[model samples]
Target: MNSQKCYALLIEKPKTFEESERYCETIGGTLVSFSSENEFKILKGRHSKKKFWIGLKQVNEDWEWMDTTAIVYSQWKERNVTRDVFKDQKCMFVSGTGDWHRENCEKKLYFLCKFNRMRLT
Candidate 1:
C-alpha cells in the first residue's frame, strides 16, 4: 500500500491563471508550488504528458511564488532572455517535458492545486 501523502490536485481543464487560482481556493487548496526536486518529481510522475500551471509568476521584476512561499527551486528551460519578453510573459507553467516556461496569464491552460494533507489518526 502507498503510505506517501499526496496533497496535489491536477485540474485538466483550460482556464486562465487567475481563474485557476480561484478554483483552487474554492477547493481548499492553492496553486501547486514546487519547492524541491523531489516534489517536482512527484508532480511530474503524477501528471505525465500534461502541461499545467504552477504557483509561480513574475513580481517586481523577479520571479515569485503566488502562494508567497520562498523561491527555493527552479527548472526553467534555456531560452533567449529579453526584458520585453519577460514583461509580457508574466505567469509560468510546467511543460509536458517537465520544463518551466513563462507565459501570459490570460492564456488558458490546465492547472494543479496543492493543500496540506492531514494525518489520519
Candidate 2:
C-alpha cells in the first residue's frame, strides 16, 4: 500500500481562481502546492491531458503558494513576459503538457486541491 500522506483532488468544474480557492476550503483542503520537483512531476503526470490550477500565484513580483510558502521549485513553460502592471491578478496552473503557466485570476479553469490523508482518513 502507498505510504504517502498527501493526496490531491481534481475538481473538474471550471471556476475562477478565487472561486476555486474558496471551494477547496469548503472541502477542508487547499489548492495543491508542490514541495519538490519530483512531487510536481508525479502529480502532473497523474493528471495529464487536462489543464488545472495549482496553489501558486504571483504576489506583486513574487510567486508563492496559497499558504504563503516560497516556491523552491518550478517548471515554467516559456511564454511572453509582457504584462499590464495594473491590470489583474496573475494565477498559475499546470498545463496538460505538465508545465506551469501564468494566467489572469478572472479566467475560469479546473483546479486541484490537496489534503493530508492523516486528517482525512
Candidate 3:
C-alpha cells in the first residue's frame, strides 16, 4: 500500500541498505541508478515522506550516483550540503523527490536496483 515506485531490485520485504545492495547483486543488478530526471521522478516518494536508497557514494569528498548511468543533470536537494561530510561514508540513497541522502557504507534501507536485460556484447 505504499505510494512509492515498485522496483524489482528491492526484496519484497524491507531490507537494510547493505542487505538491499547485496540482494540487488543476486538479481544481476545493483541498487538502481537514477541519473536522468525521468528515472529520478519514478522514485519520488513514499506513503509517509520517508527517504529511500539509491546507488550512489562519496569518495574523497565527492558525491556520485552508481557508475551504471552517467549523470545527465543534478538537482541536489536543499538540505544536501553535507555531501562527503564524512571520510569513509560511501554509497548513497536518494529520496525527497530530487534530493539525496548519504549514509555510512553499511547503513541499511530498502533500495531500488536495476540491471540491463542483456550484456552489451
User: All predictions: root-mean-square deviation over Cα?
Assistant: 2.9, 3.1, 5.8
After superposition, the stretches of candidate 3 with alpha carbons farther than 4 Å from their true spots are: 1-16, 45-50, 78-85, 96-98, 118-121
lDDT of 3 at 95: 56
Clashing pairs for model 2 are: none
Candidate 3 per-residue lDDT, tens place, 1-121, comes to 1123335534366676677777777777777666567655655543224456776665466665554456565655536545345445565666545466456766656667666565347
Query: What is the TM-score of candidate 3?
Result: 0.64
Worst 10 residues of 3 by lDDT: 1-10
lDDT of each: 0.81, 0.77, 0.59
TM-scores of the models, in the given order?
0.86, 0.82, 0.64
lDDT string, candidate 1, 71-111, tens digits:
88888884753468577888889999999998999999999
Instruction: Name the lDDT value of residue 74 in candidate 2.
Output: 79
Worst 10 residues of 1 by lDDT: 1-10
Query: Where is model 1 more than 4 Å wrong at Cα?
Result: 1-5, 79-82
**Selected candidate, larger TM-score, 1 vs 2:** 1
Give the Å error, residue 34, model 1. Answer: 1.0
